[model samples]
Target chain A: MKLGVLFSGGKDSLFACWQAIQKEEVACLITVVSQNPESYMFHTPNIRLAALQAEAAGFPLVEVETAGEKEEELLDLKRALLAARERYGIEGVVTGAILSVYQAARVQRICRELGLWCFNPLWLADQEAYMEELIGAGFTVVIAGVFSAPFDESWLGREIDRRTLDELRAIAQKYQVTLTGEGGELETFVVDAPFFAQKIAIEEASKVYRNYNGVLRIERAGLVAK
Target chain B: MILVVDLCYRDGSLSRDEFVAPVERILCRAETPFLTRHYTAVGAPDLKSADAAILCGTALMDTGYMEQPELFRWLLSFERPVLGISSGMLALAAAFGGGTEPCCEIGMVDVNVLAPDPLFAGQEVFPAYEVHEHAVRVPGEFVALAASDRCVQAIRHRSLPLYGLLFYPEVRNEWIVERFLGLAARQSP
Candidate 1:
């Protein structure tokens, strides 16, 4: 069945999309421009970049902008789904909700309201195994934000390594943080994937550290082959 | 300082997984101490010395405790403030009342707080992310602290050395966590 994968430009969403394409029918990519997503608000942050993901996965991009919070966010999503369902005739939707029911429930509700079946490709999967599957599938996912107190600015721009995965497994037991960053502990972005015809490369980047968190901004991003 | 009572078969529950890390986070947030112990290494000093206690959930039948009775008796002997999540709540109920019946598994369900309770921290209404399978009816005298749209979510022995929580408040959300920390901090000193 043709499916619309909700693309957040995050590693999980990108992986979800790839999973759908693997099943042979990813029809489109959708993203929400949140007013308070901790990134750009006016437009869907990283979606202008999604043209690359669309090219990578050979799918069309649909950008939905919600310039406010919660209810407005839901409304924006409903509009996007209805349009996608009508235009693409999508049978189902795929999402990347690792442990937060907040996002998953909203997506299910919207799909129910729109007469679309909701498909969460990554629901209830083991956290470590999930990350491994993401990396094993060959995606260059990077840390986009960090709110976990134990993490530092030095972690920004550090490619997710096996060591980092091991560290997440070990320290997560010590601190009770989810391996998937479910509590807004951190955010991520995928720069490359197996499905990508071309990969995202960052030439000019700067890391800015703050009291509780930091961001590694990619001033320049371009498409390149792995 | 805090004490954790962990007595259960492995893998039937996940509360013990979050039990230590969670209290440690709250203690770290409040600048308190986090402790650990083994069933073999501990004696009365391990529990009676703590400001509060946390009992990790278990799927091991209360019948085992009844068969042995000594360990369960020792656990109830602590008389320190207690917080029970999942099977821990069953243990608390069995400690005062009787055993639990096997019921439908519960997870990702929403819980609404019934107020004038310390765990809820005076909120009129809010959501709790639940991940449990079974719960016991509170003893006749215990007060219900929180409830879902269905069964009892929590119970507390009024005016005593115990409190029981059906939800893992530590990882539930930041708000309930802040409330749990506030009360934990007050109790610490």
Candidate 2:
């Protein structure tokens, strides 16, 4: 009667978990943390606050630390996913894989190895529709990181909105950045979502632009219980 | 035909992170104006489910689907449309007609092509950015759209909307990025 959802604190993962709570019964959320300075398999840096995300989703959090290399990271993830399935006695694995086969294939492989049902409710949906859904569902997300190109310091603290979406779309058309940032042209974090039990409240934040690398870096993300 | 090179692959794994840029380059370049997901391997994401799909390249060529062979089989079943570049191109070549052989490896280079095309637009030959080692031998039925002096650079299937290429058109300069995306931009997602 329970399932484990991969929680990323992004529009897709957060929304996936919310849908699981509504459409199926899920007990807890499992996330993987690769502490390495550069991680290929994990979401982003400073997600240590995922504990905060766990609290908001009303689920327990479990994370596995990864070090060195993507294959190694996937191996660690497979172990964590299998252990979570066993320890939680969960019947299914829920994912937010809309387009990337990299994450979906790995999750499916792990679920198969773990003998659990794999559910990707958002799989293959239209990117525009998904973005509209995130906004329509009341999720507030912001840009978190940017490579020196495509986007720079000016993009660091930008909000995800019609204008930002428009910019991303224009950039994709003009420069080839996908609307979803799936290609790593950019990445984002959701500050709040429709299912949040408590909104993530930041006392104050600064968009410190790293001029050399020149990115608006977000720091000091804190959560407040509703 | 479209070519996407995923920087997320092995050698391109700058400081142990790759796969993302190459795919991002193609998607950003393609700007298909649709929701996109990332799949671990060739068939993992089930491209057949979408109205149209683009396959990004990989780091190293692996054995079989890094996820499932069924997904590639599913893709071949699709008559709608699909674009494959680099590793994606190789994977689709195997699925639609037959196997792939080694060609120019990773990194940037100029590509030469011949013949008129649906995807390539018009021009005798153009310099598309290059990546990947695999060269595919297209089925006789699939028309060869573009080719370098060394190999078959691009191919389109006779009966289906499927296309594959050996290079990375998305890796071209910014103007080409917009121009390439313009092909699919008007179509509804």
Best by lDDT: 1
Clashing pairs in 1: none
Span of 10 residues, lowest total lDDT, candidate 1 chain B: B9-18
> Which portions of model 1 show Cα errors greater than 4 Å?
A38-48, B1-189
Query: Which ten-residue region of model 2 chain A has the weakest summed lDDT?
Result: A209-218
Local distance difference test values of all predictions, in order: 0.64, 0.62
Compute the lDDT of residue B133 as modeled in candidate 1: 44
- Candidate 2's chain A scores what TM-score? 0.88
lDDT of 2 by residue, A177-209 (tens): 677877666667777877778877655456544
Give model 1's clash tally: 0
**TM-scores for every predicted model:** 0.55, 0.54
